[model samples]
Target: MAQTKNLEVWLRGPLPDMPPLLQPIAHALLQAREEVQSFMQDFPEELIWERPAGVASVGYHLQHLAGILDRLFTYARGEALTDEQLASLYAEGKPVEAADQVSALMQQYEQRVDRALEQLRQTDENTLTETRRVGRAQVESTVHGLLFHAAEHTMRHVGQLLVTARILREKTQA
Candidate 1:
């Protein structure tokens, strides 16, 4: 109990000053990537190689996230992708029955995460104020809005990947 209290005190310290809009989005992106990479590291080779039925396997989720980031990047540049393009992006490097693997998926996802983080870091107050007119989305978004949404999207998928990893681990250990 004493140790726990001391640990809590250490953890609950002051943080450095950061712009309000940039701070949360940056932190969230970093956390999401850490979680995804940590979970992926635990996945066994056999499990990563197998295409689980009726659901996205680890590889699928990683590649899907990479594609989403690319689309978000495109959107940030004021271009909109069609539904077919979005679908193709998600399906671009999927397990090809006899040839695909998880290494490629991890590589793609890591690259996307790095690129998105770079973009997030570059956002400024002016950039945040720049408005973007997305196609029929009922809400116009700014660069900051898109950055935050991208972080949220990555977080959502990271949660799923964590669950998938846990399930695989449990199955293997059982």
Candidate 2:
């Protein structure tokens, strides 16, 4: 078992290139990533798609985490989802033969986070209040709203993943 470290990503200080107002957003994202990575270390692949207590499986949460971040970041850029993005969104929870491993999913999520952080770096704090549209419904929101949502949503899924992962581990141990 790996020894638990400080757990809080914010204690490392603000991310470079992230705007002041967006520091919390970056902190939340980094925190989620750190927790997810640690919690997933050495996790069994066989249980990735196992649903415990009728809740979503760990695989779904991992895939959704990456997909949601990609979609939210795309919206934050005042852009629409491309066909590829739409396909990815539609396929979030379902398992695929390839790319089903925990490491692959984690790599995808880490890459998405990198992209989101890059977007945050380029975001003009002054424009955070500017209106942005979301999804095919084109719901109204602001840049700040989207960014904050990305962090909170990521954390929410992280929480679910943690619980599910723990349950799976306990079952295996038993």
Q: Estimate each model's TM-score.
A: 0.73, 0.94
What C-alpha lDDT does candidate 2 achieve relative to the native structure? 0.90
Candidate 1 per-residue lDDT, tens place, 50-84, comes to: 44455567766777778777777667767788787
Q: Write candidate 2's Cα lDDT for 104-166 as tens digits.
A: 888899999999888899999999999999977889999999999999999999999999999
Report lDDT (CA) for all predictions.
0.67, 0.90
Which number leads on lDDT? 2
Q: Candidate 2: where is the Cα deviation over 4 Å?
A: 1-7
Model 1 earns a TM-score of 0.73
lDDT of 2 at 167: 99
Clashing pairs in 1: none
Worst 10 residues of 2 by lDDT: 1-10
Judge candidate 2 at residue 39 and give its lDDT: 96
